[model samples]
Target: MDTHLKMIDFDFEKLRPIGLTQVVVNSLGAMQDTTPPGSRLMRIVETQRDWFTLHDGDAEHRARIAQRLVNVLQMQDSTVTVGDWAVVTEGGADDLWIAALLAPVTQIARRANDGRRQSLASNVDTALLTMGLDDDFNPRRVERYIAMVRAGDVAPVVVLTKSDIARDAQERIAMLRERLPASVPIVAVNGMSEHARTELMPWLHQGQTLVLLGSSGAGKSTLTNTLTGAFTQDTGGVRRGDGRGMHTTTARSMHLCPQGACIIDTPGLRTWRPDADGAALAAAFDDIETLARQCQFRDCRHQGEPGCAVQQHIAPDRLMNFRKLMRDAERSEQTPLERIAIRKKWKSLHKAGAVRARDKRR
Candidate 1:
């Protein structure tokens, strides 16, 4: 078998795709502990419908998702995503089937409208939270993305692209540095420069996997091109009025960087609702969470409570955003019926309030 893998560089971590060596060990038909000594662990670089593109750092091949792989798990959005490792048996295009998915060390995903997970990538060591300094800049959206990264347990690094043309780009960077945790790393860069690659070198170590996460037209692909030293992905411009970019990269695909790291670039997302809990929210809002602990009551909701520490310490807008995320998280946990009921309840309350106000005028 011509197992085509090129040892690019030892500097980058090939920690993913468990069997990059392609030493075929057959695993049983199921996701069992023991291998049958003929299956290879292949990392999924890109998934197209029922088919997947597997890369073991050396060779790239295609395989189909086996019908009997698992009883229907609710991945209605898509079965497989970029950066998933799969147990497989070597065969020609039509003969191969992905036996099972290798559990990812970390997964960055978003909640679909139908209550399913839309995976951006799996086993990503660092999530590059890219945002444009131009029209695309929004602190509110960045806060949501921070929460999303926290939900996935991946290290979040802020990358402010297009510094050359952005208005007061340095000021924006300074503001973000203050807004986010002192521990979280932030860098402003020209997406087309070698500076962008150098700025992110710490996270691009050997065997490390990085994922590009930002809205469409946020310069994710351009950054990928700069890092990889090629035009591997397409690029697009943002709208002039709103500063929103066109969705240039329509699919989530993994690439091997010339710098010896694996990177996944995803499409622009207009709506990103994280499937998060209290801990995730707290982690994202670290400064505010710390202040919350100082409140007089253990169950301080931070709403005008006599000695509400979070309200007193944090800015009103930041606190409001945190509270909004809390409400969203709670709402997400509700079943469809419960959500409908809550909506109706709110409508009824608003109607009653309107009636009372009209009577008060009388």
Candidate 2:
């Protein structure tokens, strides 16, 4: 056959022109060998969903794609998330045309309220947890947000909004720094000003993903608007009695910043359920952990226990903070038996769906 004719054939097959001939030869070679070439011909799938919006690239993308694949395979989606980069078969010949051009796949699961679940955003390097200094500032709430972000293995950076509102901004910052791990960067900013943008510039690099989390009236939406340089989202006033803002942002949506970074903004959560356990809580409260290790008992509660290393070395205020956080974590943790039960419930629900489908076909 003429070289031009071969090139035309390759284009018709939708394979890249440069490697067309080599691919054909390789396929033939594989077919002639003892092993089947099925593995080489499969196409990986990628899907994304965000909770705040039906649009793609939100936190929900991870869950949606995972569920779809699991349903297709008649298995649990939670077990096979987007991050695993699984092998899948092409549905038809059309996939073969574009199969070679596919990029590495990463699936993200959706956020769920009933229990701890995975939410993935591909290529996310940082998770920015925002809180305003007005009525919305709460150390306990920040701890919860930290746990959620850390659960996803994303680096957490705390951004304090509405710094202008605080009478003593530095004092507030010091309190937060004392409570949170020193490694986590804490920045207080006036969201509407250029100063805030300057402080956040380093994390806004292209291709990096960040998620803004806070309660209503915390200035997360304001910060989003400020960072994007446009009134892309609506704003609402906070309550007069308390500085807490109304729940204006209803969904989690991802936007591309002018600087090339990607950000996911979620609605103000009135109640945040942390999806992590002892280790994540420990990391969030490293100082407490360090002190606890010095306590007399292997399992020191830090309450009235004699020779308690935590009590001995740490200040009363710091110990109180530690105890409060530990109690919060204890409430958040699910016993092994409870987890098993929850998993079984989900599996049963999936099984029932399968049975219904089989009956419909029959």
Candidate with the greatest lDDT versus the true structure: 1
**Number of clashing residue pairs, candidate 1:** 15
Candidate 1 ranges beyond 4 A from true positions: 1-37, 75-78, 90-94, 354-362
Q: Could you tell me every candidate's TM-score relative to the true structure?
A: 0.86, 0.64
Best by TM-score: 1
138: Cα error in model 1, Å: 0.9
The TM-score of predicted model 2 comes to: 0.64
Per-residue accuracy of model 2 over 111-163 as CA lDDT, tens digit each? 34665544444334576788877767787677666655665567889999889
Off by over 4 Å in 2: 1-113, 116-123, 313-362
Q: How big is the RMSD of model 2?
A: 13.2
Candidate 1 lDDT over residue span 1-362, tens digit each: 33212211111134333223212222222354443345666788887876788875567888887676644434433457788777776556456677777556678877787777677788777889999999888887888888878788888888999999999888988887777778778888999999888988887765678888888888999999999889999998988887778888878998877666888999888887767776676688888878878999999888899999888777787778887888878877788899899899999999999999999999
